[model samples]
Target: MFDKIKQKIEKAKGALEHSDERVLASIPETSGLSKKDIYRNRYNHGVNLGGCFILEKWIYESVFDKGGDNEFDAVSSQVNHSSVDEAASKLTKHYNDYISKIDWNWLKNEAGITSFRIPIGYWHVGNGQLLDELPFEPLREVYSRAKPWDILKNLINKAAEYDIGVLIDVHGLPGGANTDMHSGCKNSSPSFFNKSKHIDKMVNVVLPFICRDACVNCENVIGLQVVNEAVFDNSAHGQKSYYSRAVAALNRIDPGLPVVISDGWWPDQWADWLGQTNLAAKVVVDSHVYRCFSAEDKGKDANQIINHLSESISWPRDRIDFVVGEFSCVLDEETWRKTAGNRDEWVRKFGKVQTSNFANVASWGWFFWTLQFQYGDGGEWGLVPMVKKGAIPRRPQGSPTVDENRVKEIINEHIAYWKDKGGDAMEHWRFEDGLRGAIADINAFAQFDNSRIGRWKALAMQRRAQYISRKGDSKYMWEWDQGFQRAIDEFGRY
Candidate 1:
C-alpha cells in the first residue's frame, strides 16, 4: 500500500512537471479568458474533488476506523490528546496532509478540466448544522474557527494560475444531509431534512465565500452548491419545496452568483420547481446519473452497459438547464465479464461516449466523479489515469468569444440597480481577489460585526423556520459539549 501511494504521488509530480512537454505540445485550445468566464461563456468541463475535504470514500480500513466521515468523527477518533492544545495539533497535521495531497496543477494542465467542484463538509466551517450543538463545537474551538480552509482557498487561487474556475460544493450538511456515510452519518432515516437547524447551519456554512455573501469574496468560485444529495423520498420532507427554501436563502445572500440545486432523481420535478420560483435561468440544476448502482444496468452486457446513457443523455439539453454533477466509466460485473476480449478498447469507447454525450448535452457541463482517489489508484474512475490513457480527451474545443463590452455594460447596469437600492455594490465573483483575501475578509467580517449581513441572516432564519418544524429529538448528539471537554481532559498520550 505504501509503495503504491509513493508511486502515485511520484507520477503526479512527473505529470505536473512534464505534461506540457509530453502531451500538450502547445497551449491547449481550451485555454483562454477563463476563470470566472468559465461559468457563463461556455459549458464547464470539470471534475469533482470528492473525498478531499468533506468525506473519505476510501477502501482503507484505517481511515474508516479513524472516522473520516466527518470532522467530528475524525477529531474524536484520530486525536489522542490530554489537552485541547494537543488535539488541535493532531487535527491541524491530519487535515493539512489531507488537503495538501491535491495536485491542482495536474488537474488543470494534465486532465485539462475547466472547472473544479470541491466537496466541503459543514464542520470545516466555524458553525455547521447547528452552531450550539455537540460534534459541532469541536470544529470551532479546535481549528482557529475553520482557518484550515486555507488549503481550499489556495487551490482556488492556484487554479486561476491555470485559468480554471471552482465551484464550492457543500457536500455534507449538519446532522447528515442523506443516509450515506459521506453525509457524515449513515442512517436510513436522514436527520438533515427532519430538522430545521440543519438548514440554518447550511446557511451558516455557505454565506461566506459567496461573492455577495459579504464584502469579501473568492474570485475563481463560479458557483455555490447548497447541498450534495439531500435524499428525496415520497414524503413531504423529500419534496422540492424544501429546496426552494434553501434556494431562497442562498439567492438572498448572493443573487448574481449561481446557486446550484441537485436534480435529486427528479429531473422534471426539479426543473419545474426552479422554474416556478423564477430562478430557472438564474440557478443551475445538478443531476448525478450512474448506471453501476442500478439493477436495470447490472444484467446488461458490455455494449448495453456503455450505451445506457444514450437514451437520456440529451434530456437536460432538450428540456432544461443542468449539469451532470457526477459520472464515471465503471461498469457492472456482467458488463466487465462480457468485455474479456480487448478490454482496453471497450473502456476507451465507453469513456469517450460518456464524455462526448455529456459535453454535447449536459446543459451546464459535466464533472467526472473525481480526479483521483485512494492515494494514487487513479483507477478506471480516476480522471488522472483516464487522461493518461487518452480514454478522456483533455483538449477542450475553443468556445466562441464572449462579448466583453456587453458584459461590462450589464455589470454597470447591475451595479446601478443595487446602488439605487441603497446597498453598496459588491465586487462580485469576477472582480474579487482569490481565496487568501476572501478568508481574511471573512475572518474580519466576524471580528468587526459586519453590518451588511443583517438582511441575509434574517432571510436565512425565516427560511429555516419556514421549512421542517422543530418537533423531533432536540437532544440528539446532546452530550457533545461534555464529550469535547472529556476528550480534551482525558488525554495522557495514546
Candidate 2:
C-alpha cells in the first residue's frame, strides 16, 4: 500500500497541473472488506469526528462562534463580506484549518478505532439545502469557493490509508431536524418532519459513497447515515415511515449498503420493526445515551448511575440490534463534585463499564462521541483525552463472549440426548452439524445465562418494567415501553 501510494505521489508530481483532489484520490484503500463486514455481527469500535466537517452543537460556541449564534451566523459575521467570492475565500481558510487540526494518523494507528463518523450538513452538496428553507447565502459562498465536499471526499480517501472505515453522517438536514443549531437553523419547530423531498436531497448527496464505480473506491468508506439527531414524535420525523422511505430509497440503490438511523428518541419502538423487516440485516439503529442532559442526574452517584445504565438501559438494549451512538465518561456536575478518589481513576472505571456494557449488549459496539476538536478540547468527555490518559481502551474487546467450557458441556449433553433418543434415526443428523448447531446456541444464550429468547423476553420485561415504573425520565417512556413489549412479541419464543 505504501509503495502504491508513493508511486501515485511520484506520478502526481510529474503531472503538476493535476488538482490536489485528484492527487489525493489516487491513494488506494487497501482494506478489501466491504461495509457488510463491519456490520455483520462485528462490533463497531470507533470514534465520532464531530465538529470537523460540520460545526457541531457542542463545539459551536467554542470554535465556530466568534460573536454569532451558529456555524452559519458565525461564518457570515466573521467574513463580513458583500462579495460572494470574498466570503468563500475566507470560509475556505477556516474550513481547511479545522480539517488540518484533526490527527487521522493517531486516530487509526494509536487510538485503535475501527471506524470514524464524518458529519456533514445537507447543504454540503454545495450551495443550497432546500427549496424554501435556509438560504445560507453567506455560508454557501464559502462552501462554493472552498468546494468543501471535495475536501471531505479527499479526507475519506485519506483515512483509507490506515484502513479505517468512515460512517458518512448527514448531521444537518434542510430545516432544523431538531431544535439544535447543528441542524443548520435553530427553529424549535422541526421543519424536516413534513418534508419528504428533503430526505431525497440528502440521499442524492450520499449515493456516491455507497455506490462507487468498478474502478476506484475506498473499502473503509463503509456506509451513510440519513440524518444525525432527527426529532421523532409519533409524527413522520423520527418514526418508521420516515425511515422506511429513506431505507427503501437506499435499498433500491443498493440493498447491501448499511443504513444507520438515530433511534429518534424511541429506540425501543423499532426493535420489532427492524428485526422483522427485509432491511433488518442492512439497518443499524443509533441510540444516544447521555446522562448529562437531564436534571435527574443531579442526585445520582457513579455507582447509582452505572447500575441504572446497566439494568434499565444496557441489558434491555441487548434485546435489539443497536449501537450507543453518543456517550461520555464525564459525570453530571453535581456527581463530579461529590465523587472521591482520583478523578482520572473514576473516569477510567466509568468508561470501562460503559464500553463493556455496549460490547456485551448492543449488537454493534459504541463510538466515543468525538476525537479532538480545538487545541485543548479533549479531557473526560473526549475520546482522545480518555485514550491519552488511559481512561478508555484503544481497541475494544471482542463481542460479549460465551463460556466456551460451558458451551462444550451443553453440546456434549445435547449430543448424548440425541444419541439416547435416536438409534437408527441418529444417522440422519451429521455429528459435526449437530455439534456446531448446539455450540452456536450455547454461545448465543450464554450472555443471558444460557437462556434462549423466550426466557430473555420474560426477564427483560420484568427488569425494564421495574426500572421504568420506578425511575424513568422522558415523558415518552410509556410509549417506548409499549414498543419494547411489542418487539418481544414479534421475535417470539425461540
Candidate 3:
C-alpha cells in the first residue's frame, strides 16, 4: 500500500510542484560564501537567544500558578509555608527575576552567541484563538497587551541591532496544537490535526510577519518558523501542508526569506521532508533533538552513551540539512534527570554546560533547549522563569554567564578540525545512522498507501497508540481503534 502511494506521488510529480514560485523570485542570491557553504545553508547551527514572552501565555490561557500572586510571588509564599506549590512558585519567581535581568546585547556582542530563536505565542500578541473571545477578564486584559505587528518589529529590531540571526517561531496555534512545548494546549487536543483551520490562522494572522520589512530588516533575520512542535499526532504531510501554505504566504510578500520547518516531535526516527520542498535556495530546514528520557541513560558504559547520542540524532542528519535547533548533553545523570522536567533548572544548567562532547561533531551550531523558566523539574532549560501557567516562559532579563570564551575555544580547537580536513572529518551519517534505521522502519510501514491522506491517517493512529500506551490507558487505546478506523476511512475519501 505504501509503495503504491509513493508511486502515485511519483506519477503526479509534475502536478505536485513542490517549490513555491513566488519565493524564488524575491530572495537575494547566496553571496560571499563558497558554493559549499551555500549548499550547506541547512547546517548552520543557530541558537534561540534573547528573552521569550511565555509567562504571558499562562496569564492569558488561565494556567495560573495557583496562588493569586505571580508564579514567583506564589513560590515565595509556598516556600515559606513548606507547600510544594509554594516551592514551585518561589522557584518560578527566582527564575524569572534572573532572566529579566539578563543582558541580551552581551550575549551577541560580548559572548558571540550568533543566533537566537524567539517565540511569541498566538494569544500573547493578539493573534491567538481567544483574541476576540477570551473568557477570564484578567486573561482578556492581558491579551490586549501587544499587537502582532508591534512584536514582530521589536524582534526584528533586536536581531538587527545585535547582529544575530533570528527565527521568529509561531509558538502557539488556534485551538492549540497538542504539545507540552511552548504552545500550551492540553494533551491530545483534537485541534492539533485540524489542518484547514490552522492554515487559515497562518495565512491571515501569522504570515504577515514574514513579509514585514521589520522582519526582513536584515539578513540576520533568516527565516520564519511556522509552528514549534505541532506534534499532537504524527501527521507529517499535514504538518508539511500547513508549512507549505506558510511558505506560500511568505512568497507572496516577495521577501525571499527561507521558511524553517520541523518534524513534529516523535521519539523514534524521521525522514527529511524539507529536501523535496518547493522554494528558493533561501529555505533553511531545522529540527530539534533532545532524548534525555530514553532508556539509553541507564546503559552506563561510555561507549553506550556515545552510541545512544549517535543513534538519537541519526534521524535529523538524514532527513534534512538542519541545525540542532535545541539540545544538550547532561554529564550527571541524576542532575540531568531533574533538569529535563524543570524549566528553570535547565536554563541554569544550560548556561553552565557551555562545553559539550557533542559540540565537536555538531551538524549545525547548537541552541540549548532553553535560557529561562527556572522553577520546576526541567525548568533548567529556561534561563529564567516567567510566572505563567502552562507553556514555555518568555525570555527574562539579564544574561546568565556562559563560558562563551571556553565554548568558542572548544569549537575552534576541536570542531573546526572537521571543517578543515574534509576527508578526515567524521562523516555526518556516523552520528545519525542508528536513528536513520528506525525512521526507515517507519517509512517502510508508510510506503504502501498511495493516498497521502491514508498515510496521514496511519501516522495519526500510530501517534494515538503511542500516546495511549505511554499513558497506561490500554483500555482507551483499544476502545479508540474504531474511532481511528473511522478517521482513516473519512480522510481516505478525498
Candidate 4:
C-alpha cells in the first residue's frame, strides 16, 4: 500500500510538472474552497487543548488523584485500583468533558481562535494495534475500549462546523521523544531516537494513517505534527532520517497537506538545514518558546525579561514558515519575586511583548500554551483567563482592506520612475499585474474569513511557479516579485 501511494505521488508530480495551469488550478481558490484550501490560506491564532488526550498532571491535578505522574502511570494506577472497564470509563469521561461545546463556541465567537493544536499519543491511534510490542501494550485494553481516535475524529468534525482548523500533534511517540512525562511515559531515559523500529512505526504506520484519515475523512485538520519536543542529537539519533521519511510518506498520502517539525531547541540549525534541503513544499518549523524555564530567565525582572524578549526572539524571515507552537504568559516565581510592580500589571506587560514578538517573527502566528486548566482560572497559562485579562488580543487585528486609490498611486510612481530608464525594455505591466494579483488574493481571503493569508512564502512560491509556467522565464520577472512584496508591505502598514 505504501509503495503504491509513492508511485501515485510520483505520477501526480510528473503530470503537474508538465502543465502550469493544472498546477495553478490545483491551488484552491477562495470562493469555493475544500478543507485543505482553508487550512492552507488562513493565519493561525491558535491555542493548545492540553491535558485532554495527552494527560498532564500539572494541567489538571484532580485527574491524577489516583497517584500517577504521567499518562502511563495514570492508566496503570487506575487499572490496578479498579477494573480495566472502569479505568477506561473514567478516562473516557475525562476526554468527553475536557472541552465542551460551550468552550468551542467561546473559542470561535468570543476569543477568535482560528486553530487548535491537539496532542495525542501513538497508543491513541489504531486503538490497540499500534501499542503492540511497545511499552504501552500492557494498557492497550484500556485505550482500545476507550477509543480515543474515534473521539478525536468527532472533535475534528466539530471544529470544521465552527470553521476552525486542527493540527493533530503526535505528542507521544512509541518509546518517548523526550524524558518529559508528557511523552506518554514515565521513563527516566528516552529511547525513541535510539530505536529504529520506534521511528519506523511513527513515520510509516502512524503518520500515514493520520494523513489519510485527516485529508480524506477530516478535512479541518490543518497538519500532522511529526513529533513534539524531540530532545536528541539531530545527526546521531536518526532524527533527520526520520523527518525525511515522514515528509515523503505524508506528501505521498496528500501533497496538499502540510507537515510540522519541532526545532529540537535548535531553531537556527534547523532553519539553515531546511533552507538547504529539498524536504517538502509545505514544511513548517514549530518552535516552543518559553522564558520561564532557564536560569537566566528566572533571574530577570519583568521589564528585563520583556527587553530580553524584544532583543532575542527573532527568526530568519525568508527561509521557512515557523510558528511559536507553544508559549505561555507565566514567568518563574523567582522573577516575579524580583519585580516590584503589581502582578496583574506585569502579567499583562509580559503577555503583550511575547505576542508582539511572535506576531512579528512567526509565519503562522502563535498558540498559547493551553486553553484551560482545572483550577482557579489558569492565571497566565490559560487562554480563557488571559483573554479575559486583555493579555492576548481577542482576535488578530482585523484584515486590511486594499485601498485602490493608494494602489494606483504606487503603480504610477513605479511606472514614472522606470519609464525614462527602460523605455520599451522594461515590462512595467507585469508589476501592475502582480500587484493586482496580490490584492485579489488578499480580498479573496478577506471574503472567506476576514483574514490575511498565512504561509505567504509558500503561497508566493506557488504564484511564482504559476507565472513562470504561463509566461515562460524572463529577466523582467523580478518586477512582479517586487510588486507583490510591495503590496504585502502595504497591507502590513494597515
Candidate 5:
C-alpha cells in the first residue's frame, strides 16, 4: 500500500506547477490552513508525555523494579518470569492507564498546554513488525499483541477534542541514537550512524508509515519528530543524511506536514545547514537544553547559572524554526547548595528565566521535560508541579486585540514619518495590505482556540511568496515586508 502511495506521489511531483501548490493542495478548503500553517506557526506551550509508550525506569520505576533497566530488559524479564501473553497483558495495561482523559483536562485547563510531544519507539510501529534484524526483533510478539500504535492513534484523536496538537516523536530508533536508557535499551552503544540498514528502515519504512497514517488519520498531529536527542558527534553526518531522506519521504505524502529534527547538541551547525538547504516542507530544529547535566552548570550558583543562560543561549533566528524541545526547573544539587536563598524561591526564578528566554528566542515555544512520573508529580521536572508552585505560567499572555481603527492609526504614523524622506513611487498601500493580512491570519487562528500566531518569519515568507505570485512582483515588495513585520511586533502593545 505504501509503495503504491509513494509511486503516485513521485509521479505527482513532476506534474505540479509550483512547489507551493503541493503544500496548498493538501490544506482543507474549509479551514484555509495547511497542517504546517496551523501547527508550525503557533507558539507551542507543550509537555513531553514520557514513560508511557517508551519505558524509562527513572520516570516509572515500578515496571523496572520487578525487571531490568530499560524497555528491552523489562520485556525480556517479564517474558522470562511469566509467559509472553502475561507480559503483553501487563504492558498493555500500562499503555492504557499511564495517561488518561482526566490528565488531558488538567493539561488543557490548568496548565494551558497547547501541544504534546508523545515519544514512541520504532518497534511500536505497525504491530512491531518493523523491528526486524534490530535488537527488539525477538520481543516483537510482546508489542504485537499490546498494539501500541493503535493506542497512540487513539491518544492523538483524544488530544484533538481539547484542540491540542501532537508531535509524534520516534524517540527510540532502529539502532540506539544515543547510549541513554531512554533510547529503548540499557548501556547500548550508538551504532545507528554506522549501520546502513538501520537508516534504511527509518527512511523507508518507519517514517513513511508515520506520515501516511498518523498525520493523515490523526487530525491533531502537529508534526513528526524524526529522532530525539541524537548523539552530537557520533551521528552528525548520518543524522543529516537521514533527515534529508526523511523530509523527502514525508513531503511526498503530505507536503504541508512539518518534519522535526534534533539539534544533536549543536544548534549553530544545524542552523547553518538549514539556511543553505532549500526544503520543500517546513523543518524544525529541536534543541533540548538542560542545565543540571553539565559540569560547568554544576559549578555555578542559581544566579550565576541564570546569568550564564541568558548570556549564552542563542538561536540563529534568520535560518531555522527552532524550539527548546525539552527543559526543566531542576538544577544540580551543587548549584542549589551554593545558592544563598530559599530553594523554592530559586526554583521559581530559574523557571521564570528559562520560560522567558524560550519565548523570546525559540520560533516555536518550549515543552517541559515530562508531564508526569509514576510515583508522584515530577517536582521541578514536571509541568503540573511547576505551574502549581508559581514557576511556569499557567498560560501565555493572550495576544491583544487589534481593531481596524487601531491599525489605521499606526499606518498613518508610518506614512507621516516616511513622507518627506521617501520617493513618490513608494507603495504605502502595500504596507496597508500586509498589515491587514497579518491581522486576518491572527484572527483566524484565535477562532480555533484563542491561540496566538508564532513562527512569524515562516508565515511571512509563505505569505510574501503567495502575494508576489498573485499581485505580480514589484520593486516595492519591501513595503509589504515591513508592514507585515510591524504588525507582528506591535500586535500586543495596543
Candidate 6:
C-alpha cells in the first residue's frame, strides 16, 4: 500500500510537470524568461494563509498598541530590537511556545489537513513606521534576529511528525493587505491600488527566508504563497509581474518547489490571466468562496451550490487546480443569530452555502478563515482562537464542547479513513457519490424539507432584491443568485 502510494505520488509529480508543458504551450513566455529561468516561472500551487501576523487580529492589536489592557502588553512594551539576533531571541521562545501548545498530530491526522500557512509579521521583522524608505533594509537587523528559518524548522519538525506540508505566506504587505488590518507599517494607508511598492522590500527582505535551507526541504516545506489575498483593484499588472519574478528567483534556489499565486477575490479573472507571459505554467489559481464575502449564494440548495462550484472551475479545470482558500457558513437562523449576537445573517448564509457546496470541489482543500476572528462569528476558524478582544471572556470556539480530544478524534478518523481508502477512493466518496449522500441527509431531516427551504430562500431573495435596489449593483445576492438557481434547476425537484 505504501509502495502504491509512492508510485501514485511519482505519477502525480510527473503529470504536474507535464501539465506545466501544456500550460506553457498555451501561454507565451515573458521575454527572455526560460523554463530553467527562475524569473520565468510564475505559477503557485498548494495551501496557504491560516494564522500568523495580519490574520491574528487580536494578537496584533493587543501586542502593538501601547494603550490597551492587551494580552501582549509585556511583549509589546519593549524597545524595538537593534539587531537580527536580538529579534530572533525576543520572539523565538514565544513563537516556539505557541506552536508547542497546538495539537499538531491531531491537526494533521484528524482534520484530513495538510499544510501549515505561517504568516510573517512586519514589526516582528523590524520594518516599523520609523523606517521610511524602499528595500526596508533597516529591517534586516530585526529579521535576522527573529529567526524565521529557526521557527520554520520547529514547525516543519512538528509537521513531519504527522506527515503534513508547510507553505509560508507573507501576510502583511507594506501598506497592509487591506486598510482594516494594520501590521506592516504605521500610517499604513490602504493599498488597494498602490501595492506595487511591496515588491522591492520583499525582494530584499523576504526572499532569504524562501531561499534558505530550512525552506528547501520538500518533506515539509512545499512552497511559498507570495501574499495572502492580494487586493487586485490595485496594481494588477505589477502584482502579476512581481509574482512571476518572485517565482523565477525562488526556483533558482529550489527548482522542485512550486509557488502559489493568490488571485484577487475574483478567481475567474485567472482564466485570462493564465495566458499572460510567464504565469500560466507555474501557477495554481486561488479563489475564496465566502457566500458572505462574494454574496454569490443567497438562496441556493446543496445540489445547486455544488453545480456553482463546478461551473466556476470550467476555465481552469483542465490546467490549474484551485484552492478554496477560505470558507465557513451558518446553518440555522436562530442558533446563528444567538451565536453571532447580532443580525449578520449574510455571514451565516455564506457559511451554509460553502458547507453545502464543498463536495463538488475539483482540486482543493481549505485553510478556513483564520485561526480566530472578532465580532459575532468570533471563535470561528481553523480549530483555534487567537487572543480575544471585542468580546469578553476570550475562549476557544466550542470550548468545552470542541476540545482538542474531540477535535483530534474527528481529525484522526478523517485522516485514517483517507489514508486507508487512499486518495482515489477518498475522491470517489467525496466527489462522485457524496452528492447523493448529502441530499439524502438533508432530505432525511424532516425539518429541512426542500419545499420549506425553497420558500425561505424565496423570501430571502425578495429581501435581497429590495436591498440591491437601494445598494446598487452588487454580488451580495448570494445563494439567491443565478449561479445557485442553475444548480437547483439541474437537480430537478427533490
Q: Estimate each model's TM-score.
A: 0.67, 0.71, 0.52, 0.88, 0.88, 0.54
Regions of candidate 1 where Cα sits further than 4 Å from its true position: 1-41, 57-71, 80-87, 127-130, 204-216, 235-239, 397-494
Candidate 4 residue-wise lDDT, 201-249, digit = tens: 7877888887877655566788888889878475634677788788889
Better of 4 and 5 by lDDT: 5
lDDT of 1: 0.54
| lDDT to native, each model | 0.54, 0.57, 0.42, 0.77, 0.78, 0.43
Please list the residue runs of candidate 3 whose C-alpha ends up more than 4 Å from where it truly belongs after superposition.
1-46, 49-51, 56-100, 126-141, 146-152, 232-235, 265-272, 277-282, 296-303, 315-319, 331-364, 373-494
Q: TM-score of model 5 relative to the true fold? A: 0.88
What RMSD, rounded to one decimal, does every model reach? 19.4, 14.3, 18.8, 6.8, 7.4, 16.7
Candidate 2 root-mean-square deviation in Å: 14.3
Mark the 10 consecutive residues where model 3 has the least summed lDDT.
Answer: 22-31
lDDT of 1 by residue, 97-128 (tens): 65567677676666666678888766665323
Candidates 1 and 3 compared: the better one by TM-score is 1
Across 138-221, the per-residue lDDT of candidate 6 in tens digits comes to 554454555545566666677666655566665555555554343344433545235555666565455545556556654566
Error of 1 at 326 (Å): 1.0
Better candidate by TM-score, 5 or 6: 5
Error of 4 at 179 (Å): 1.1
Best by lDDT: 5
Report the number of backbone clashes for model 1: 2
